[model samples]
Target: MESLFHPTGNQHILDRIDKLTPIKLSEWGVMTVSQMMEHCKMPLQVVYGTKHIKVNPLIKLLFGRRAKKQFTSAHPFGKGMPTAKEFKVNFEPDFETAKRELKELVEKFSREGKEGIKVTDHPLFGKMTYEEIDVAQWKHLDHHLKQFGV
Candidate 1:
């Protein structure tokens, strides 16, 4: 599993993020460049503070095991994360700001280390540990980065 807290992994993603431009386009999903950046920042938003979260009991029962694998494995994420109502960034956000936010959040995670890592009630995954948080952060970012050939 790639730890964003590690220098190499952090550098890898940071470098990729730095390379992003408004001209970038995804190879798979339909998100615009701005939306993609907003998406990249979602996990961080969840960690730093809640923008929006909605986890219910049935959701926890269904997604709990899947969430566990995400914490410790190199498995690719399923298409589309469970989005929170508050995290949607749909106003044609500024590309420069999105890029900056993405880099900043990742850096915060790197600086925080494992102790810094923590997950709360996901809108779907219920109670998540930092382990679960790391995988989702990495996997989701990786998927989108690859989508844009970053």
Candidate 2:
């Protein structure tokens, strides 16, 4: 797993993020550029603070399996999984503002690093390691960025 704090990984991910434009359109996903920006927010919300959704047993049983495997491996997310309800942005988002927010959050996550971390319940995945969290984070953004043909 790439450490969120590692210079190479952090810089590389940030570079991809830096390339986003307000007018960017996805070649695949339904989300617009701003929606993609908001989608990026979900992982930041998980890391920077509390994830509002509590872990339920059944959800943990199903989504958790794929989530665990996702983190443990470098494999990119394939299309098909249901998008989280909260992350489904519907309103028009300020493009420049969203870009600014995305860049800042990635920087903050990198600076924080993985140290003495505790497992947190994901909306889908049950519990995730700090390493898993970092990899999951990078891969997710990478997937969407590629979706937008970035």
Candidate 3:
């Protein structure tokens, strides 16, 4: 899997993000480009301890590992997958602001690399290693960027 920890993969993601514009429509899913950019930041924020998502205990126990495995695997995320409510952007976000913020976060994640992740236990994914986090993060950004047809 391409990892954000690697320079080339990181730059690829950043370049794809730059291709997004305010008027860009998703090839699939309901998020506008700006909203999708904002949504992308949520998982990274959780890694940095800047955001928290409360997962149902029962749900986590039942499906967390399986979901995590699938997410971090080489397979790309399918279109129109359900997201956690916390990651949903209900209000409009400024396009440039969201783009700038997402790029900044991506850069920060690349700079700090695995050691930067403050949380190893994902609420919905149970325990995760640094390698898993890198794959999951890259996959997520790739999936959303593909959504915008970038």
Highest lDDT model number? 3
Candidate 2 lDDT, 22-105, residue by residue in tens: 777788768888888877876777666644655667877877797679656877788655676767788888888888888887
Q: Write the per-residue lDDT of candidate 3 for residues 9-71, one digit (tens) a residue.
A: 889999999988899998999888989999999999999899988999999999898899888
Greater lDDT among 1 and 2 belongs to 1
Checking candidate 3 for backbone clashes, the offending pairs are none
Off by over 4 Å in 1: 67-72, 78-87, 118-123
In candidate 2, which residue ranges exceed 4 Å CA deviation? Answer: 115-119
Per-model TM-score versus the true fold: 0.82, 0.86, 0.97
Ranking by TM-score: 3, 2, 1
Clashes of each: 0, 0, 0
Q: Which candidate do you rate higher for TM-score, 2 or 3?
A: 3
Give lDDT tens digits, candidate 1, residues 26-72: 78766888888887788777776745566667866887667756644
